[model samples]
Target: MTEEQLDKLRLDGTKVRVVRDALELNDVVGFVVAWDDENVLIRRPNRRVVKLKRSYAIVPASEPRPDVLTEN
Candidate 1:
């Protein structure tokens, strides 16, 4: 994802589709991340470990992050 796209996700709390590694998908998680050039580091839900790019993943709009950390 691009910086602008990440920013938009942060602003609107929108869901984002990403390609991540399968090894990292051991648990259900939601995170807000700043995308880098080739990958991103997203903070896992409940303050869990942050996963780097692995395979493909999708995060919902209702997911929590530093900006929208509270559930509606």
Candidate 2:
């Protein structure tokens, strides 16, 4: 598969996978493990198990700025 395909797979809404980062939730933070077909297995910010699928999207965390600083 092409690199683009792989990236799409990672971001596809129907794709089943884990989010490799901890997230914040209402005063806590933790990582998301996997999606349980119906719900997402999130490692609760408080170190507990919680299922949630409120919102999720695969996108670059940061992008290069278009404007550059140059000195003459």
Candidate 3:
């Protein structure tokens, strides 16, 4: 995401789901705490902060509901 977009997420204090590695499809769910040009710090539900690359895919936590729930 762009810097402006990231800043919005951070400012909004929105819980976000970050895909640090698309290949693994492992999601790190957290709130955007801080960020720089290269990395972002996410405060996880466990109250731990994780630093991830700015290039990673980040989305609002409430979105992207499970497919099982969406499917009939």
The candidate scoring highest on lDDT is: 3
Winner of 2 and 3 under lDDT: 3
Q: For model 2, how does the per-residue alpha-carbon lDDT over 1-72 read when each residue is reduced to its tens digit?
A: 234533454455232323323432222223444554455554543567666553433222233222212311
Give all candidates' CA lDDT scores.
Answer: 0.50, 0.38, 0.80
Against the correct fold, how does model 3 do in TM-score? 0.75
Error of 2 at 50 (Å): 0.9
lDDT by residue for model 3 (1-72), tens: 887888899888889988654333578898998888899999999999999997767889888733432333
Off by over 4 Å in 1: 14-28, 54-72
lDDT of 2: 0.38
Worst 10 residues of 1 by lDDT: 63-72
lDDT of 1 at 57: 49
Off by over 4 Å in 3: 22-25, 65-72
Cα lDDT for residue 60, model 3? 90
State residue 8's C-alpha deviation in candidate 2, in Å.
12
